[model samples]
Target: MSLTANLMKTGDAKDGAGSEFLAFTLGSEEYGIDILKVQEIRGYEAVTRIANAPEFIKGVINLRGIIIPVVDMRIKFNLGTPTYDQFTVVIILNIGGRIMGMVVDSVSDVTTLSPDQIKPAPEMGSAFNSDYMIGLGTIDERMLILVDIDKLMSSGEMGLIDKMAA
Candidate 1:
């Protein structure tokens, strides 16, 4: 079965398993997003830089004739210098019918977290805005920064996503 379908099936249990999230790393921190938003994961590749585009927006990549904008999470969050290595990956996401790629350090795995395991994101001043955070997910000893990918991607500042469709 497709990963999406499989994950959906796994999450379908009425036992209150809550939602599934695709976990990925951005620097040393781990983050998670709703697995349903993820279309696929791909190895990082060179992109054609857009003239005058924001620094965080690396550029666009032609995926089977359709050009999709790729955003570098490290640069966008001011994590530090980003290195392109075998571990680097681009998470292709389908947000509101718009396909886009997000560059992350690497993908770990899909995790299932119950509602009780999620805690509200603390209001704080940081490079990554809390407004776009779903909450903090705790699984054993690991704490994942749960991101609201749709909100972050369609925010006014990104500009890459069309406002009308967002």
Candidate 2:
């Protein structure tokens, strides 16, 4: 079964355990986002470029007749030069009724973390703003930088800087 199907099948399998997150890699670091926001996962492909769009905004792609904008998390977060390989994939997301795509490295798996396993993101200076972080999730010896996809996608930095300044 597909990841989406797996998600639907186990929607409430861990009802009282905690929330689930879809783990994906950007560069060397691993990140996780709320699984509920993901629509589907697709392999990376060439996209139709838009005139004068930001470098971070790779382009757009047609998904079942719907055109959605694609954003490269590596470029957006300044992680490193992004490389497209067999493992690279686009994670289609539905944010506030608007559909979009995020390109990332290989996806690992769905992780269910209890409340006790989540730790607050420490407030500090870094390349990535803490505002976009939900927190840090710990499972075994691995750690996931939980991302608040909704906030990050709709934040002031994402084309809202001008509007917010007014």
Candidate 3:
């Protein structure tokens, strides 16, 4: 959809609580990511594992001619063992001019959420970090955990992304 149309449907990102999010599933939970950061969505493909890389970093995939690092959200979040099926999806994100891919269980659809509908994420515990969370968005009875993909992708733990960008 065009920018004007999107704004009309979802509201204004700057002025109001309106921002579009790409909803995806990880385990049994629903998560939302800023639509602006999403470059493309593709089906899961076999990736070449990287040597001496973190377990969460599932290695790289050659996109066109560029090899982009892929991270498994299930492993990163300790959700459980992830199974790659025909329905698995890879969300390609462009953050800070660097491109990376995130493996997700399945992608639903893009939903527009207003700020008023999003509530602050509750604290789980000291061990449970919510630093990368933007907030919790509510749509009807479903709650979408909004993530700051840019922050999560550029974090020090995501060393591969930094190395690739350099």
Candidate 4:
């Protein structure tokens, strides 16, 4: 299925109670993810590559002996390849019972967006799709691309990694 269809499905799954996001930056754009799914954030480190893995999969990192696959959000979001340097950090997130890490350029600050503040993602015909984006959050003058990490991960696609780890 397409990313937009997946996001629409996820948006419909949730009833209420509001949601919070941890904002971060990749290149010039700002993005956010549900805070409840974020496990932890750590500095970038060398990871062990897995054979025959997806291009977006950076590799597996042993986080205190629990191996977790890391995805380069830059590539996954079609934001292009990221130049890793001192500012790079890994945002470990748990989505749909799977633990994965995403390498981001840098992390901004956490922001809360009530249901009212979020507007459904805008549809634009282009190479880069906005299906993973749940909505656009406006806080003050800054715009946060509220991302549905679960949909972004596409749990079904990651089932292989989970099976390997199991």
Reference-based TM-score, model 1 = 0.89
Query: After superposing candidate 3, which stretches have Cα over 4 Å from the reference?
Result: 1-17, 126-128, 164-166
Instruction: Arrange candidates, best TM-score first.
Output: 2, 1, 3, 4
Per-residue lDDT for 1-104 in model 2, tens only?
38667767767777668989999998888999999899989999999877767788888888998878888999999898999999999999998887889999
True lDDT of residue 87, candidate 3:
72
TM-scores across all candidates? Answer: 0.89, 0.91, 0.87, 0.82
Give candidate 4's total backbone clashes. Answer: 0
Candidate 4 Cα deviation (angstroms), residue 31: 0.3
Cα lDDT tens digits, model 4, 22-73, are 8889889999998778777888999888888787788899998888988888
What C-alpha lDDT, on a 0 to 100 scale, does residue 163 get in candidate 2?
31
Sliding window of 10 residues with minimal summed lDDT for model 3: 1-10
Worst 10 residues of 2 by lDDT: 157-166
- Candidate 4's TM-score reads 0.82
Query: Model 3, 1-166: lDDT tens per residue?
Result: 2432543444344554478898999989999999888888889999888777888888889999988999999898888899999879898899888889999999887788877989998877643369888899999999999998887887888966567434
Question: Between 2 and 3, whose lDDT is larger?
Answer: 2
Better of 1 and 4 by TM-score: 1
Q: After superposition, how far is residue 62 of candidate 4 from its true place, in Å?
A: 0.5
What is the TM-score (0 to 1) of candidate 3? 0.87
Candidate 1 vs 4: which has more lDDT: 1
